[model samples]
Target chain A: MLGLSITQWLFGTLSLMAIMFALMMVFTRSPVNSALYLIMTFFCIAGHYLLLNAQFLAVVQIVVYAGAIMVLFLYIIMLMNLNADEEPRKHVLTRAIAAIIGGMLLFVMIGALRGAEQLQIVQGGASQIGLVKNLGKVLFTEFLFPFEIASVLLLAALVGAIMIGKRDTNINTK
Target chain B: MLNGIPINYYIMLSAVLFIIGAVGVMARRNAIIIFMCIELMLNAVNLMLVAFSTLHNDANGQVFVFFIMAVAAAEVAVGLAILSMVYRNFKSIDIDLLSRLKN
Candidate 1:
């Protein structure tokens, strides 16, 4: 007992789980297993959103990322019949260099963020901005134009996916 | 100070996650796995945005996160479609083998 409160405990646990699963996703060779691990990571992130009191975003994260996007990923993997770990291994030197580069990047970012602790965050008591009603109001009122554009983007993506995924029937007939 | 948990913790967590994703992207040859790593990076950024939203006691950051999710979803759709098309044409999805465009 480090005298930590329940929220702090939960945050620690969720973040640890998230990092572990994310690493597993990367390390696993099987695409299906990688996808499963990524889904677990998404769930942990949803938990963090809940801890942040962003109820709407938390629900959306679960619904969209864990539910829809991951399902699509799995569906594609299955459709392609790529359930095995058939990926050709990269050279050891390449892997080592990538790891070193990533480590350096992390070091630089953490160094830049050293003063983050001193930055004062406003402590607004019992903020309700995370509620659906408040978020919906902001989405519709101030962010209305972007909201509509997102819809159009979704539509374009829908049509484009269908067009790209469909087989070339004309070539087959010839 | 969210329940005595410093905002720095969230920042540190996201930074680590983002690095892991970047490494995965750099090291992996599978296109699907690379795409998943990109998603991981996006989620890391999303976490940071939500944390800042709570820090500022504002909803705007959360709104930005919403738009980001939409864009990510659309991106996944088109990317997967292209991936499947590549598979159909080559009977494989290895990124290294798809280097005909380099010529």
Candidate 2:
């Protein structure tokens, strides 16, 4: 039962942290504060990855989501200098409806899950396939084409962002 | 004790996180905040993927998580650039003010 308690503790704490921060991200008035909370949520998720024995993914999650993507979010927020002052207040009815819809979706998903066969959670001690060596082999060998394609997709996104963001002086003359 | 936690717990956690994200997306008017909510949804999906990967004892799901991360990064780059452009033109990032298409 020691193993069960430890698993429950870790999963419980991580999920609680993740859920709270995600809620804070959504409910917070300031976009900057929302971004900060989202970053914390990412860290909590990365901790879950670590618990699952996916060390490489945990590290990548931090670097890409927390480090790179969040930096971009913050940079945009800073650039725009957004604040709650400009926000149009949402109606109480609209918020209530949204809450009802979201709650319903959660209920449906959980209900569907109730019939599923209980999965025996893998213990923490065993080395699983999430190791870098195993994942790298699979990524480069079986998933090689998709891997290259992802780079291309990233390049396209980079170019598209640059084009869209560039100032067009000709619009006034046109 | 550590290994004995049922997988349903993780799934429930994912569902809760996803619901929060979905609610945020529907309720928030600020475009940037909505975008952050979308990220939360993506992270919830990632958590589910990793949990399943552990269940199946396969690395494929982990690899998929890597792709998802790359795609998310690209998406943020382009999406944020678009948001900045919208702010430049409208002087506001509120979704309601972006109703020029509502002819």
Off by over 4 Å in 2: A1-4
User: Candidate 2 lDDT, tens digit per residue, A84-169?
Assistant: 66665578899999999998998899889989998776668574688888999999999999999999999999999999899878
Q: Using alpha carbons, what is the TM-score of model 2?
A: 0.96
Q: In model 1, which residue pairs have backbone atoms overlapping below 3 Å?
A: none
Winning model by DockQ: 2
lDDT by residue for model 2 (B10-52), tens: 8998899999999998998999988998988998899999988
> What do the candidate models score in CA lDDT, each in turn?
0.91, 0.88
lDDT of 1: 0.91
State the DockQ of every prediction.
0.68, 0.80
Winner by lDDT: 1
Residue by residue across B58-88, what tens digits does model 1's lDDT show? 8999999999999999999999999999999
| Stretch of 10 with least lDDT, candidate 2 chain B | B1-10
TM-score of chain A of each: 0.93, 0.94
DockQ of 1: 0.68
lDDT of 1 by residue, A24-98 (tens): 999998999999999999999999888888889999999999999999999999998886546667889999999
